[model samples]
Target: MSAREEVLARLRAALAGAPPVVPAPGPVPRRQGDRPPGRPELVELLRQRLVDYRAEVHRAAGADVAGTVAAILAAAGARTLVVPAGLPADWRPGTVEVVVDEDLPAARLAGLDAVLTAAAVAVAETGTIVLDAGADQGRRALSLLPDLHVCVVRPAQVVGIVPEALDRLTPGRPLTWISGPSATSDIELSRVEGVHGPRRLHVVLTDG
Candidate 1:
């Protein structure tokens, strides 16, 4: 017999009476929804599911986005904010104790009130905000250290599904996927939010 046949004969001798392998079952397709999910329908479904996660979402168009971001920070009572090095000047909030990414020391981050950033893409289907540390988005540390985070995302940047979001993100670079606030459930079944990351997450969607 050939070497391959010899190997197979030895294996069969070791467990000659064993049953053939059986494949495991997978999740069944649900009939929960009446219709299939198209891109437009997926976006809407994503929006609704994100709301179910208790995320606050805002929308604005064109030049109004700047003013909207400023208002969001103001309403949240945020004073110190980490701004990206390459963020658009017009997107900045006026008169907030702005701290640039480079200027922020790692040790003092716990005291920071909030962080303002942009996203690589917003996956509506999963209610996820993706970060690739690009010009618009800042270092991953800035998002992690602060208690509250405000993300500015353009409507055109919103994709219908996770695969589409993956295409926009960088391969080896730092990627942060945030879905709602940082939360965990206790053994007693009580839920607590914001333990490891930001306590609150607010997303501002600008359409231009």
Candidate 2:
């Protein structure tokens, strides 16, 4: 027999007693209470995971969000800031020049010192922050081109697992999942940061 035929014959013999495969009809329904309720521990776990990924983490009361944002920008020495159209006005630091994004060109975006945005949801288990291009989050380029990214996450927006995060998101909107500052290693294992995206990530978690 030809080599291809011989191989096929042997595979059929090996599976002679194997059960027929069945495909799932749809996504399995999650059990009730499978999703953990929001708690202080979830926030703490998120903080630990974010720090482990080398992201700067800060906590702030709801009323102090603007001040916390301003402080972070000042410490980073950010002279110019880019923000989405729907970003809260108070969050824009008075110390720096703020530019609201209006489909800014890539060149203009690259020259900015930092970008501030509100996250749609965050996964504590994986230390991932997601952006859904909502009014508070501009197009993907806003987050991708800047050197520094400061994202604010509310306690209610943080989830314990990926599935929970997914359930909270809409399928049609463009989503950006960020774990940490962008980095990659070279052939000799030398680490490089900011090669693909922002080199610095600062997460501000706000208490409700």
- Indicate which candidate wins on TM-score: 2
User: lDDT of each prediction vs. the true structure?
Assistant: 0.76, 0.89
> In angstroms, how far off is 162's CA in candidate 1?
1.7
**Which candidate has the top score in lDDT?**
2
TM-score of 1: 0.76
- Judged by whole-model lDDT over C-alpha atoms, candidate 2 comes out at 0.89
lDDT of 2 by residue, 1-208 (tens): 9999999999998879675578646787773225463578888888999998889999998888778888999999888999999987767777788999999999999999999999999988889999999999899999989899999998888888888888899999999999989978874796666677999999999888
Candidate 1 residue runs with Cα over 4 Å from true position: 1-44, 189-191
- Shift of residue 144 alpha carbon in model 1, Å: 1.0
Clashing pairs in model 1, backbone N/Cα/C closer than 3 A: none
